[model samples]
Target chain A: MVQINAPMVGKVLSVDVKPGDQVKKNDVVLTLEAMKMQIKVYAPADGKVVEVNANAGDVVNTDTVLVTLE
Target chain B: MDQLWEIFGGIGIVHLTPGHVVMWLIAFILFYLAIKKGVEPLLLLPIGFGVFAANFPLTGLTEEGGLFYIFYHYGIETELIPPLIFLGLGAMTDFGPVIANPKTLLLGAAAQLGVYAAFFGALLMGYNVAQAACIGIIGGADGPTSIFLSANLAPEMLGAVSVAAYSYMALVPIIIPPIAKLLTTKQERAMVMTQMRMVSKTEKIIFPVLASVIIILLVPKSAPLIAMFMLGNLFMESGAVERLTNVSRNELMNIVTILLGLGVGSTMTAETFLTWKTIGVFVMGVVAFAFATASGVLIAKLMNLFTKNKVNPLIGAAGVSAVPMAARVVHNMGAEANPQNYLLMHAMGPNVAGVIGTAVAAGAFISAIL
Candidate 1:
């Protein structure tokens, strides 16, 4: 299991993946909005998403677990 | 009957002039822009109200010992509020991008070409040097710096210059895109910049101090704004002064913004604001913004010629110091050209640097003129 953590402080703009969905390394898993700019968060490795911890409009801090992948 | 006539004569409407009515129209336009259009409402709303109140004849609101007069006199004329605004700005700003990529500082500096362009333009239009200097700073796209410089150099032109600076800043999205497009090819706009290196906490904490020392040393006249700015940044980056940081960026910022806006707005009396020069300020302001945007883009292209890592020339337009707005514009432009390109973070380096660049420019003007 691997946990995908937020790269920085921002509000989650969207979560692109769900549990049981497959993602390739570097695939955008979510979008975060900070400083009025939207940043795409990429998957670190190939994985099947197991749990999503944040929702659109949720403010997240750096290192907050955003998704758990198996 | 004579007493009744005297009472009627003392009424505000009896004192109204055509110029006062014109000022009211201008104030209403500001109101429409602030409330209906939601453009820069925080400052414009109070400024609009200030304009409205000041225009009412016999109110004494902008006279000696009046509320707005006090705000303008102690807050702006004394050179207090703009620096305080910079304090809050510094606290809110994150200099990580600038620390990670110092080269963007040049992009910030290059944008100043617009300042000189406007300065020369203003001089050609027959404004005295001080007034031209104040007008030139409108190109910096920094409201506080423009206010600071105008208050110091040309208090008479403060209303025109501040209005121009903030109006143009809110119009960054509209102003930057065409200029950026005109200069860069589709391929240059589409270039993807790599992620900036992570900046350590030590680097962040040290940056404000080093920058303050260096910048103030270089431009001693800038010490007021730069010192407070770096101090506010220190509060944020030190990790031990979170409380101070919070207040500086939030409550203090809000309080000062109201005072600053109202003070600036109150200065827009019909006698002061309704002038051929006010129109000239608006014209030169747009010219300054366009030149600043073009110069930033051109400098980025110039830097590309020598650098190994190709920078998306779109990020250059972010060097006008409109904070996240300019950066967001660059990011959106980059995304439109190439979906994979995320220039937001890369643009931030120049965005923040532009703030410093503008302060230094204002300081240089002050040093040379005053």
Candidate 2:
């Protein structure tokens, strides 16, 4: 399993993938908003999401695990 | 009867002039605009109260050893508050769009034509070179930059220049649209720009340091404003100094803005603001903005003539230093032309670039004049 961490301090605006969903490399898995800017966290590699750790509207810090992929 | 007249004699009524009452009315109008019209309340509110406070008969508020005096001396005349405000603005800005499209820097540079145009206009109107340069910067549409230049080059005209700059900034929504629509066709307005690439974290982190080094090396006169601005951007992009970013963007920004506005407003004595030159300053300011908007759009059209990729000329109008407000005006105009179009992100490139470009232009004027 691989963990995906939040890259910046921001509110999680959306979770685009859930457990059992497939994502391609570079596909946006979640969106975060910081300093009124939208930041998209992309999938590092082709994978199936195994866990989702954050919800929309959750304020997150850098490196907080946001999802897990298998 | 003699006692009653004598009792009131020592009060301020005898010394008050019609000009003082008119100044009071102007202050109240500013208050009404801030509260009711929501026209840059953050700035207009403090400025309105400062004008009212300064006009209290024989208060000395605008004289030596007074509150407004200290604010103007320590904060504005010393050139401290404007740079601090730039720091906050830098922290709040996202330079990703600018990084994504480097060509938009031209739009920023193009918008500066307004400043030069206004400079010549002021000069023709018989203002000295220093005063004309200060008046011209009102075209930059950045209040702090206008104030900074005015304080340094032509301290006497600071009141008129600052008022024109801020008032035009607040009027961006109303002023930019008509000019933008008049300049572009429906096809040009609806031109859909491609999405900007995702800028990497390394690039984001390096930008401020790199920009500071380059800009300062080229125009050392702009060092104070540019240095603080880059430092704030670095703090945000580094992500290691979250507290610094928060404070820079929030508390520090708010405090500096209040002091800055009050300091500027206190300079507006009836003797300064009531002149025919003041009217000329305001008139030239509109001309500057109109020309700035036109030039941005025209430049975009010119660039499209040379490039395969077409840009929406509307984004050119966003090249003024009003930041997101100017960008939003561009976006709305694009949307009006085509509902599916999203030009906000693209317009932001020139919007932020205008901030840097304005600073550079101010530096050029400073270097040339003084």
Candidate 3:
């Protein structure tokens, strides 16, 4: 399983991915906010979502684990 | 007229030639643009004041031991001004995003095409290589970077180059959009980018060091600017240096910005500033900036052709170093292209990287000149 990582230091605005949901290589798993704007987190490769690690209102920084892909 | 000339000549400071007075008015107009138009006022206000003070007959500000004169001579002429500006800039930048997305570094480098293109363009116009490189750095929209290079390469044109860089920075909002629109279509603008991966705090904290090490090794001349910028980012991310970071960003940055602006303004003495070269430098600045923005977008468009992932060409325009302002402009334009499109975060990668890229280019220019 490959893990999706957070790309910046910011608060989690929301999670777009869910556990056990089929996802594409570039599908956004979550939105992270920083510098007064939000950025989406994309899957690194094509996979089926196996687990979600973070949720809404989470404060995240770079390399924070967001999702695990099977 | 003889008596007036004699009285002013006794000052041995300001020549008060007719050309000098015209330059003073020109300097005032620059300040007016800063204050009224809300363009890069941090530097422009003091620069304007400096010009006004320097131009008045017998002010004694720029003379040896004279206070403003001392400010100019000690700081700018001696090359202390640009580094101090870097100190403040280091305090002001946040490197979290760039560290999180290291690939964006490529975008930053891509944006520097403007600098190279303008450099050659200047050469075509009869400027020597050093002078052309100095003028080319204007596209980076980074003040200290431009000043640092110009001081080393083309000190004779320092005033014009500095003014051109700062003025174009203020004009980033105005200059980038048309070029972006002209080069890109609506579908290309509306294109959404995959979200960036989260950058860990540990990674964030280590990023400045790692980036500085890597970047400095690749471009040694960029060390001063890059090192200082990385130091500021370190202070911001270290958490242990909260007080230092706060002071650096707020008090240090604000104070230096004021002095730096004024000191730079002093360079705009009427006699040297108002000339055909001033017009040439200004035109060169716009060309440099335009080319830089266009190059970024065009590179993205070209890359999109090979990649099916669909790169948004609009993000390329953010590759210049104007920071969030240029990124925000991209966001606004992207939304205009398609209401559902949000390019802000994606735009930021290039925007922040542009800052570092321009600084590196400045470093490269200094090296070539030296």
Candidate closest to the true structure, highest lDDT: 1
- TM-score per candidate: 0.91, 0.84, 0.81
Instruction: Return the TM-scores of chain A for each candidate in numbered order.
Output: 0.95, 0.95, 0.91
**Across residues A16-69, which tens digit of lDDT does each residue of candidate 3 receive?**
978888888667778878667776666767888888888889997546788899
* Per-residue lDDT of candidate 2, residues B1-370 (tens digit): 8998788867887778877887788889889989999988999889888877887677889899999999999999999999999999999888888898888989988999988998999999999999998888988899889999999999989988987888899999999999988988998887878756778889999989998999999988888788989999999999999999999999999999999989988988787788898898999999999888989999999999999877888998999989888987887788678644567778888999899988888888888889
DockQ of 3: 0.10
lDDT of 1: 0.91
lDDT of 3 by residue, B67-128 (tens): 77677667666777676666656766666556655556667778899999999999998889
DockQ (model 2, Cα) = 0.06
What's the distance in Å from true for residue B322, model 2? 0.5
Error of 1 at B241 (Å): 1.3
What is the CAPRI rating of model 1's predicted complex?
acceptable
Model 1 Cα lDDT, one tens digit per residue, A1-70 = 8888776678999999988999997788999998866788778788999999999999987568999888
Between prediction 1 and prediction 2, the one with superior DockQ is 1
Model 1 chain A poorest 10 in a row by lDDT: A1-10
RMSD each, Å:
3.1, 6.1, 6.5
